[model samples]
Target chain A: MRHHNIRKHLSAYAHQECSKDEHNIIENHIKTCIKCALTVNEYQQVANFSKQIPERSIPSEFIDQLKRDTLKNIEISKQKHYPPFRRLAFAGIFLLLIGTVTLHIVNPKTPVEYISSSDTLKLDEMEHLASILCNKENLIAIIDQPIPIHSLIVTLKQMKKLNQRHGQVNNMFERIMHQINGNVLQEFPTPLSSCKIGGKFDESGLTQMITCLRSYQRYNDTITFRYIASYYQKIRS
Target chain B: MELHQVIQKYQRPMVAIACRMLGNLEEAKDAVQEAFIRFWKSDTQIKGDPFSLLCRILINHCIDKLRKQTFRRFFSITEIKDLDIMKSNENPHKSLENKQLVDHVEKLTTRLKPVQKAVFILRDMQGYSIQEISDLTGFPENNIRVNLHLARKNMRKWLQPILKED
Candidate 1:
């Protein structure tokens, strides 16, 4: 091997890493080569000097302290990163829940909302009354009872007139009208129930009224028709 | 593996490497401690050798300290002293001689560029094979070899006059 080749292998050679053949080659060559021999010596000294640098004795107390301190720091970081509470909860989702709760709590000043329109407020109140007055069974019964077209028209007109004046109709018919009017307050006059018809009529009494109204419908010239006609005419005017 | 286990395994070697790099025992301990702390905090897995990754973190921290040291030196600030590494009540001649050699070698190392110094320390001082050094540092073997060669040559310039006595 050339001098440079042997020099490259010198570190390996110093560590006894070279193959027998390669080691012999360097040995024979360097025996004649003064510079190569000195170079090997220098490499040896370099290795020895580095190894001679004493291992700084880590104090026994220092080792224990380091372990204790490191464990403490690890615990702190783990807690900051993932507290036990967060681990029990649904990880990232818990953070989102915390943020949501914090947001709700941060802004506690809920402004009182005012109805911009009195008409709208009244309509909402009427809608609420309709919901409460017309229970599901009562609504279903009124719908199931078959009123002929004439009774239906007369009942609607009377409901409209009653809503316009008192809005205090008996609960039973009031429920029926509220249901039939599609729960729209405008469909009946405002202030429902013009006068008390004693107490509410049961299903049978309501059927009787439907029959009477159907008879009355034939007399289009009757006073009731005149009154109904006059009311519509007045609304139109 | 548990974080304390990894720290137990690597702390001494890491502190040694950091001491050589930073030239201050306390600073080296702090740097290695920080490395352990970082390893504990990282959610990453140790790909191959846990100790190698920890050394890499520690060496990077040492380099950052060296950079800060440079900034301080530029301002003519006094550097940390109290670099006593010898065992007390030993033979005075051997202790003083070893101290002088260590001082001279470390002083020569400080002259070398950071990359070369690290390569030299990894290879010569720490007894890491070139391949192991490459694996630990992510440097190509050729780059490590070149730096090691340069670092050794630089040190030889400082020590050659004295090694003639040996």
Candidate 2:
């Protein structure tokens, strides 16, 4: 091999990292090549000097501090994973309450009752009816009524439109109509009961019912003529 | 092995490797401590040698620190400080000479890329075999060899004038 080729391996050569055949070639080359030999010597010297770099003995205090810090970190991590008894108890109770509320909303205990045609409701009774339908205390009862799945879906869509309109239009005409005729009408149109649409009371239907009631309560501040008009519009449509 | 025992047994050597890689004892200690904490947090029932695993963790941590230091150095105006050369009471003259040699080595090694510095330190300073370095660093033996060769070549170039002056 040329001197240049042999010179490239000099670092590995100093460390004896070369193959036996390569080592023999380099050794023979170095015997005749003074420059290559000098380069090899320099490489060896660098390796030797690096080896002589003293290892620092860790301070005893540093070890103690590291142990304390590491153990403290481990303890903190352990606490993170396994919470304390009272905190765990609080979490458990909080979860139980949430689960109970969810279960009550999902599957109410109040049975479905059919409203008779003679049980006419006055317009002034809308507020009382809304309170019964949308009140948190009566939420389970409202969800328990056997609402037709199709009607609930339709009502949910209408209620969403009403909510969007209520946000956009805050005119005096609508507000005045709401205040004057809000409680004076003579009949509460039971659109839910009037619809005998055949459908199963499934999860989707219950969800729609809950959503409609939620929207009704949400827009309670403006539960005026427009809302009743929207109901009538739903009936006519 | 238990964690405390592992810390007690391997702390010195691991810190030595980190010191060489980082060129600072305090940073080395921090890196070694971080490695130990990571080992504890990780699944300890590791498949292979625990020491090698710990070495791998420490080395990677040091490399990450070096990268961040390089980045900070790039944007910041601060100058790099010289390493704290260890002093010896037995023979102050010999200690000063050794200190100069160490300072020169530290300066030369810092010029190398992180991986090259790591390979050079592991092979030349710490006396690890190429294969062991491969296992510890997860780099192929050929890659380690190339890095070692480049690192040594750089060191030789830098050390030639110093050696001649001596």
Candidate 3:
């Protein structure tokens, strides 16, 4: 009958669940009693073996299916609540406001300062030379001086037209556009030192730009010649 | 993304436990698949240690299966058939050690009520806490303690004889 209390305390001892006073009582009883000690030892062994029971691997496929199904349900729920027309209306209103504000600052009508400058002949020759060079082999190549700015602008316009017509521009047209957008092409004539070497257009400079673009082809297929023309010498609005 | 993967992950342990408890492959597989279906349908709340939750689901499912009229009759016939097959076997020595362990556990388990058998298995074999057993079985903590005590006492009576013999 006395063993009942001791036996009751054994599981608590095995699980470390006894209060300090109960724990000391159990410990004292265990030392004196072989039966309770054996019981505690057996319970501990069982507990240890139970812990070793191998954990089963949950199938990865099951988890993945659950995730997919949950996401699908979420998407379906979202669609029911948030319709396309409402989303489109919010986006359209946002874009319209942005467009109005941008137009106020970047007024497209402002003429470029370079157009009113004194060197009209150089500019005209540049334009003429640009047009003549349009059919030139390796169109990415630099033109030696005496080329008119009008010819250059016309050539750019023609390339733009060809790209628009065919819906694509080849690598050569792409390289030329890169050069025009590059720092070398953007530099003004007064500090022409950086833009000039040996008082002629840098042919090697043009070749290097084309080679650099070979790496870009993998990422960009459209071959965009578009640039922020507002920052450069003017094109009529 | 696939129910197949979830089944694969839980299958080994689930199969082992189900086979051990139900003592047949077909029933074990059915129980496991049904458990999976239940898991799929739940919006929430099968709380606490995933393994314990799964074990509860599987054990309860097997118990429910055993309760059915058809399964109860079939299981009794199968148990008799199994005993007959074992007796017919010539090589008794091969099963001796395993038989000793199984006999001891079975003797201990037969004395327990169904709930006691489950709580005992969860506590002794599965190493669940009193709280975990309560959570799994929806028994109160005191009821789990009483059941577990009765289970251990039954087992202890057998163990006393075995230890004395040793």
Q: Please provide, for model 2 over B34-101, each residue's C-alpha lDDT reduced to its tens digit, 9 standing for 90 to 100.
A: 89888887766966558888998999998888877755454222212222222213433344576677
Question: What DockQ score does model 2 reach against the true complex?
Answer: 0.47
Which docking category, incorrect, acceptable, medium or high, applies to candidate 1?
acceptable
lDDT of candidate 1 at residue A196, scale 0 to 100: 13
All candidates' chain B TM-scores are 0.76, 0.78, 0.61
Let me know the TM-score candidate 1 reaches against the reference structure. Answer: 0.50
Candidate 3: tens digits of C-alpha lDDT, residues A113-230: 2122232323344344344334333232432222233333434444444445554433444443344545334452322222211212232333332332333333432222222211
Regarding TM-score, does 1 or 3 come out ahead? 1
Q: Score the docking of each candidate (DockQ).
A: 0.31, 0.47, 0.06
Sequence-dependent TM-score of model 2: 0.59
Residue pairs in clash, model 2: none
Error of 2 at A61 (Å): 2.6
Q: Mind giving the per-residue lDDT tens digits that candidate 1 earns over A1-237?
A: 788777777755664646799999999988899987887787777767776676666786777777787788777876778656867777778889988899889963332111021222243454554565355544333332233444344444454444555554434443444344444333334322321122223433334344444444564322232222222222222
Better of 2 and 3 by TM-score: 2
The CA lDDT at A112 in model 1 is 16
Which predicted model would earn the best DockQ? 2
**Chain A TM-score of each model, in the order shown?**
0.36, 0.39, 0.29
- The lDDT for every candidate, in the order shown, is 0.61, 0.65, 0.53
Give the local distance difference test score of model 2. 0.65
- Pairs of colliding residues, candidate 1: A163-A189, A163-A190, A163-A192, A166-A191, A167-A191, A167-A192, A168-A192, A168-A193, A169-A193
